[model samples]
Target chain A: MAVSSTALVDEVVADVVDRVRGTLEDVFAAVAQVAERTTAIAAVRAAGRAPTTADLAALRPLLHERLRRRHDLISGIGFIAEPGLLGDVPAWLEWWQNHGEDGLRPLLPDLDPGTSAYSDYTHWDWFALPRATGERAVAGPYVDYLCSDEYSLTLSVPVQHGGRFLGVAAADVYLRHFEAAVLPLLRRLPAPAALVNARGRVAASTDPRHLAGSLLRSVSGRSCGPIPLTLVTALPAPRP
Target chain B: MSKLSNGALHAVFAPVGNLARVDAVVRRLADAIELGLLADGEQLPGESELATRLGVSTVTLREALMALRQQGLVTTRRGRGGGSFVTAPDQPRTARLGHRLADWSTEELRDLADHWAGVAGTAARLAAHRTEPEDLVPLQRSLEEFEAARDPAARGRVYGRLHVELAAAAQSARLTKEEIRIQAEIGALICLALGEDDARAAVVELHRALLRAVRDGDAELARSLAERRVQDAMERLIGLRLTVAG
Candidate 1:
């Protein structure tokens, strides 16, 4: 029974890992398609020129359409241009919200990312991770302090044009929403179980002791590829 | 940590508006004890310390403790190794449980059920939204106790404590206090209704489903389950009332 329980937990973890990776991959593909189809983004790539106000206006509808399509799974979606990539345009940030007052809203006043009020996104994890790793990145199930104190995760896929890195196209998912889809399976296990990130922080756990965001001490489980998350049948016994 | 030691319970210790000091102290302490926030046989602070903490006079605290003693909910010792101690609560008889239900008309019972449904639904929703895995430990433990308890009063206390713990997981003191109040009011009735072993089994299964919903962070489903549980309990009580009347 113990062996089967352990195996069952491993299978569940592997499935969750695959699903998360697949979801992010789909987001990456969607962003790539959006960049190719939108005149604003496409024209910049084709003409090898900086984006203009007209380009932003053209991109807004496309971004909103994409966000509306994924509204059920995500709260917000954005395309962040690399700082100074658009010449006089600074970095264009356009995001669509599905939360309160839902609809498309520019992070800046009047489609301008060059304003003094809008801070630089050069250092942000969503931008920095993809830029640095050149891989699709998953940021957090941590609090989105800048947006709201709600638990959230950001998935970003690097957008590139001819080997030159542009910015990242990203989406924000409220962690609770994601958990609603994932937690049922974990709870079905007979033994205590948890999904822990690479840092050993729990994303969700059936074992009440291994709490979300709490670090797991010496947890043993299966961790599959693409995502560094583990599914453990049992956490290490508590310190004496 | 003992529930009394929770900083959140401090809100109940505050003087209730428009209530006499002794009455308020009695209500607060009784409510706490009934809700399992004051565990059985746990030692309470010295009278002077408790009075200071509650912001009430020592005389009022003494009066309140005396009243609790009279009710068999508290015990006091005079010598060393002494302070006021909570009594191991007895299982209230079916007669006592039914007596509270008898006082309420069907309409009053319905209204109370309606109010309870809203409170329970909100508590479940917020608990699912805000609770961490660790936060649900108390709730899970309470459910296990409910399942294992053979005594009807023990089952009822554990049942009520489950909801109170869910409210605490919501991270809102007001909701937690409100849940405790509702639990105290409805506990006896639920106990009477769930006395049959089959009824108790059904409630446990429903509780398990509700726990799954909360664990999964499905706030809507959690709220629905909680509301349905309350509605079902109220219906059971009303059926019992009608049977007795007929």
Candidate 2:
């Protein structure tokens, strides 16, 4: 029984790793494509020259094509270049949700300060991690108030050419879907199993007793790159 | 009513009990085949012993076997060392299957997808949490079988078998039972439209990814992929229905 139980965990790990890899690769590719295409333009060359509304307007359709390819998994996609380009305010930020009758439609207010949707996103992990590391990064499984107050993970890739950082391209996926997919498997296990993130917070678990965000004892887990989520299993009682 | 004796009344009504006995026997054997629990070409025990095991009379068991034979799910041979044997499951004909499905509205298809998604998704998630490496042997074997099957019927059986394997890995008997029932109900219709090479290839890719997810213990990914697969099958059938109607 124990041997069979371990095999079940192994299968789940294999699937999660593939999905994470695929999703991250797609996000990175979309970022690279946008960076490659946008950089070719002479007008948007410096830190001060972030793409204008007209520039983003022209580029939306292209990014929409990429978004449609993974419509089943993704909720929204966004790009935020260095904030100084338009003025002192955080400008050059554009995000689109998979809404509207046809395809991806632009999210309103564009992070404007006075709007209720305003956020100091410069410090948020999704934007901050890629900027700090200058490599692909993932953030959240947190409440994304800006994107619908749904629990979501944001995968971001830094757009850089010749050591000059232009911005970051990112996508959002609701965690509910992940839970929808994963919780049942956990629930079926005879022993309790907890899915823990890098910070050691339980993301999901078979033990109905273990709530999300609670810290779980580190036992066994499988990591996917930097995410480092572990599947910790509860040990059995001592046999006399 | 008062004039009738109990024994005489039982004699008058025993056929109802016999009918039920035959039905029970038939369902037990048929469900086992549909769920892939009983392998094709497997031999049954001699009639007397089999009937005893099933706690049914020989006549009733024979009636049930005849029903199975008529449905082309079983074959009987007469000679030395001969007994009842299961026939390989056949793929449902498109026209006949489409007619049977005509009563299923788009809403019903969606509901089936929803039901399948819930069962499979949860089974995968649980399997990820509970499965050990050794438990993956059956799942991997199913994957290999699916890849090697060149014929549509073989591919279809393997495809449906994958879910049952996952449910077993989950170590949940209830989920496994539900998976078996769902497969028996819808596996034929799903396989009917997957005869096209391109469509089958796409499904194969999805299964490969799903297997990888399970192997990696990524419960979230495995669950999502399982749900998506059912949803895709339902959508494909709905589209086929639309085209046939038009």
Candidate 3:
């Protein structure tokens, strides 16, 4: 009986991890498509000369179509240009997102560093990590007041044109929706379990003590997928 | 403050929880516009929809919009794709801030300062325990910006951003959201005290020291430094209030 129960626990944990990985991979796959298209456009534009802001802005319809088609998982999608990549502008982000029944809407963040309201995207992990590492990244589970105001995870891929870094193509996934999709699988575990991001912040958890957004103290866990997320389970306390 | 897109929708449309619903709505909307959560010339949701989102009646929202218009923070259009639009206000003048400060008692200011200190100190402690060195980069950049900022308005923005980033480094979304909300309420007022070069320099030094403590993983030191930083700023603000009163 004991051996059977242990095997059952392992099976449940594997199932939850699989589902979590599958859901995130879907989002990343969508963002990867955006990055590929963006890179192709940038390469074409850069071949003639450095891409103009107008050149990049022309990609809006493409982004809008992606947002419309993937509205269930993708809350926002856009490209952020490397500073001075577009010549005149120090920084630029051309982003669009679903707006309930209104379809897609553009985001307008202040790019000027001098202003009190400026949002310097260079400082954010979602942009910074991919830029520094030249790799895809999952940046949050944090309240993203900059784009979605929802607790969200941002998936992003570095966009490069002929070995030159242009910027990044990114998408936002609302944490509530992520939880709604994953919680049922987590509930199958006999022990309390949590899904945590790279930094140990809980993304979703069956344990009230380990609420989403809180940090998980014990770092031991199984990596869920290509991403750095971990599935951490806490064994029930021994009988008193 | 508002960044554009769906985030702005959340900030602008989140329910107002105050008993004085109209006044609360007016303050919330005005704050959103001033903070740039609502872009200049951006159209607000239609009245009934906005009312439903805010959990207020259309009559109350109308009254609030009227108050916002009177303050020059919003403009309304009549027909044919007409709706209320945000008119971003200029930076608050010293005289205007003085008048706003006059509304708060010294005791209330002290209470707010204590609360602010508690939040910041706890966040710093958590950050020290949780954050990687690379995660501190934004805080470092913010400190450098604070040092370089010549004016109080710019310094105030850097100062508020540092604390918000500190909360984020702690990996607590609730704490980060709270920090953002608090900054919106007090950020403009902080400019009044930061106008002094000496005060700005002192803040820069304290922030630098606090960042170092967090980097070293000295949680206790980080907490005390954060608390001291808030208390010092509170004293400067109180002194400014007294001067304005006199």
> How displaced is residue B157 in candidate 3, in Å?
1.2
Best-matching candidate per lDDT: 3
What RMSD does model 1 have?
22.1
DockQ of each: 0.01, 0.01, 0.30
> Where does the lowest 10-residue lDDT sum fall in candidate 1 chain A?
A109-118
Per-candidate chain B TM: 0.65, 0.63, 0.81
Error of 2 at A96 (Å): 0.5
TM-score-superior candidate, 1 or 2: 1
Tens digit of per-residue lDDT, candidate 3, span A1-240: 112388788887787798889988988888888788888777787656777777777788788887878787888998988887886577788888888887788887666555544457776788889999999999878667676556789999999877888899999988887888888888787767889888777888888866786666556887897877999886333223
Model 1 agreement with the true structure over B1-246: per-residue lDDT tens digits: 233422224434544434477766765666556544466788887888788878887888899899878767789988889889988557564543454356567997899899888888987887776655655655676778788887665676567667766665654445666666666455646777787888878888888898889888888999999998888888888988876642
Q: Worst ten-residue run, lDDT, model 3 chain B?
A: B1-10
List each model's interface RMSD.
19.5, 28.2, 4.1
lDDT score for residue A60 of model 2: 79
lDDT score, candidate 2, position B137:
62
Candidate 2 residues lying further than 4 Å off, grouped into runs, are A1-20, A23-32, A35-50, A86-90, A100-103, A110-119, A181-192, A217-220, A226-228, A234-240, B1-246
lDDT of each: 0.66, 0.63, 0.78
Give the per-residue lDDT of model 2 (tens digit) for B39-99.
4786766788667666788888899899888767789889997899877557555554565
- The Cα error of candidate 1 at residue B228, in Å, is 49
